[model samples]
Target: EEDKIIEAEAQKLKEKFKEKSLTDKMKDLLIRSIYVEMLGHDGGFAHIHAINMTQKKNILSKRIGYLASTLFLDKDNELLILLVATLQRDLESESYLEVLSSLQAISRLANSQIMTATYDQVHKLLSHSSDFVRKKAVTVIHRFWQINPNGVVDIDRIMKTALCDKVPSVMAASLNYFIEVCRQKPETYKDLTSSFVVILKQIIEHKLPREYDYHRMPAPWIQMKLMEILALLGEEDEETSNQIYEVIQMTLKRAEDLAINIGHALVYQCIKTILAIYPNEALLENISKSIKAFFSSESNNLKYIGVTALNAMLKIDLKYAEDHQENVVECLECSDDTLKLKTLDLLY
Candidate 1:
């Protein structure tokens, strides 16, 4: 019955498209039909309309077309290769929005064939004039790398430049890409540690533009990302750990001064980073205080993170977590069953 309704809908859409021009209403209905087709209906009815929409001069039509194509076409679909030329043209469009839309589609729809065909165009956008375009380009390149790492030429240079991108959004996307690279081959990218450290210092000093600030905190997401990457790079490397120690201390102190919600999150990430790098006695004392402070919060989320961090701390040194026995017991009385379970684990 559902399939019958979908086929009826598709037939109505096909009749509507017979007119020389599309009204906005008709365009919307078409997009809806493509969406339904995407839901495993296998009607195979929307592909031609979707492709024609991509060739339309109207930006809205192009956007809907790209979106529909991304949703309805599988990576292995033969039709996907047909969009390579269209995507390349849009990637070079004078309008940044067009470029952004194409990049977004490629990011989602890219396969080995699509990545190889459009790799150069996407790479050029990494240095596009608009920060918005640059940010999206960085993300697309990351996706392409995942599909075919060798397709991205000079990645080391590309990443180094991206990490230092003056725009915070671009830098943030680059950090995400770098994180993936570092995770898989830490030694190859370990030398980039100082570069991340420099960025962290700049953020800590409030050098980022006011636009990146959240609740008066300077780029907390970036801060968190830097901490994450640092944690990854510094793990099991004593020299890297020592190099990052001062900034880690500064970050902890800075997070402590922010508003409660954001502060708790930063502190939680900091605790994880600390554990990864093997915190010293001083840092352990700070983590102990931070975890206990979390337990005092009325928010269950804070309590859960606190409990988890404490469990981790216990692994490093029983002495720091010993005083938190009362805090753990208090958590058992809370209404949150998940938090209770985590606390129970800690207690066990």
Candidate 2:
């Protein structure tokens, strides 16, 4: 009886939700009940709520639209059909916020038909001259590719354009997608290695938003991702390989005498890159020494990175790597399960 009463009240609120006369606060209440409060939701009422609120002209309405689209939008094509029209309108609207919400909805929903239909709109926004929109578009494209790689045409061109985009964030997103593409279709992207190396080098040497420091290093995320990409590029090309080694050496030199997780991570990435691109006794010695320094780090994250780096060297130069046996055994006493696993890997 109580459940029936609650259901009846929820239905009444859903009816009130459809009224244009309903205030934002009232609609927000309805949305919170279904999306936040976890009220028993009728699919029909939820669809009505989504459509009615999404068509309204306010941020609250759009917020509700996003919430409905993500939480309660039905799997059937019927509700999505209504949403696709609204999303298209939002995409074409002059308001970037509307476009942003639409993209967010599309990304979360992962409906292949919606992505295919909105491809042109997303492609246009990729060059929309707004860094915010472009970055979102880059992410949406990546999501699209993840959902249905075949649906995205001219993907290489899209990635190349994003990589060269003037905005650093755009380039970062582009590199993320591009790296995946390289992993999937290595042969197709080999020709672009040299160009990507140059881009990665530029980003490493002097990328902006330089104030966003991680472990006292500016933008370590970008630096690490760039280093990973460089390793991939250097796998075949001698020129690229030599350039990668030089960058790794330079990064290692800079990271020397540093004491931060990000700096250790940078060194970690550098050592990993060197192993991938140009593994040699001399380089392994440097990496082994660096990993030794990292083992002494108080931070578990740095210590784990140290263990991982040492393990990579163990596969190549077991003679030199054997020197770290005591340190690796000591890591077995660490609390972190991941570090323990890495230590076991090193030992076995």
Candidate 3:
């Protein structure tokens, strides 16, 4: 039944393309609808139409074309090679939106072939005038790194520059990239620890632009990513651990004061970081208080996070779990079975 519907839709799309009178707006609409229908199935018939759309001067048509191509073609698809020139042209286009759309398409459809063909063009966009372009470029580089690690030369140089990018969105994207890289080789990125610490300090002080604020929290996503990266780098390294201790303490204190859900999330990330670094007794007690507070929350999500954090803390020092026994027991009565199961794991 589904395949028959897709065939009908494909045939209608083909007929629409045959009509030279069809407006770009109408073409875009038809392409979008057919794209949705073609999502999971083999959409070989619409491939040529999608390719034709990429050749159109209309920006909307180009976007739909790139999107459709992403859906129809995988990394290994032979047709992907044909997109290399078009993608490269858009990557070098004077328009930032065009460059952004091309980067996005490459990021999603990236394979060894695409990465090999567009490596330099994508790399050059890292310094594009638009922060939006720069941000997307960073993610494309990250994808390229994943596709072919050896292809991305001078990674340390690339990351150092990206981490210091003035824009919050770019910085956040770079941090995500760094998190992936550092997870595999923490020692290589330990030198960049001070840089991350400085960025976190700036964020904590509300130095980022007002636009980046989420519910009055200054770039909460960036803060969370920083904490995660710090955890990875600080693990079993005393000097790296000591350098971030003060900032981590400040983060915990700040996170504790906010009443919003983002605040709770920051607090949870701080707890995980505290565990990774050998935190002092005072910090441990403070985190314990935060975990206990979660148990009192009406939100099951908060309760679940609290239970999970407590379980992790116990592994470091079973004594911490002793204080949460009552809270853990209270969780057993919650209606969420997943939360109850986590509580059971803590009990065991």
Question: Local error of candidate 3 at 181, Å?
Answer: 2.2
lDDT of 1 by residue, 187-262 (tens): 8877888988989999989999999888988899999999999999988888888888888889998998874788
Global lDDT of model 2: 0.74
Off by over 4 Å in 1: 1-20, 34-44
Q: How does residue 145 of candidate 2 score in lDDT?
A: 84
Superposed Cα deviation of residue 133, candidate 3 (Å): 1.7
For model 2, the superposed segments whose C-alpha errors exceed 4 Å read 1-21, 34-48, 73-78, 211-216, 236-239, 255-258, 333-341
Taking every candidate in turn, the Cα RMSD to the unseen true structure, in Å, is 2.6, 4.1, 2.2
Total clashing pairs for each candidate: 0, 0, 0
| Residues 1-348, model 3: lDDT tens digits | 876776677667667666776654555644655564555554465676776677677898788888777877778888887888899999989988788879988988999888888999988888989999999998898888888788898766787788778777887888877888789999988888998999899999999999988898889989999999999999988889988998999998888889899999999999999999855687788899999999889999999999999988888888887787778878998789999999999888
Candidate numbers sorted by lDDT from highest down: 3, 1, 2
Clashes of 2: 0
lDDT of each: 0.83, 0.74, 0.84
Worst 10 residues of 2 by lDDT: 35-44
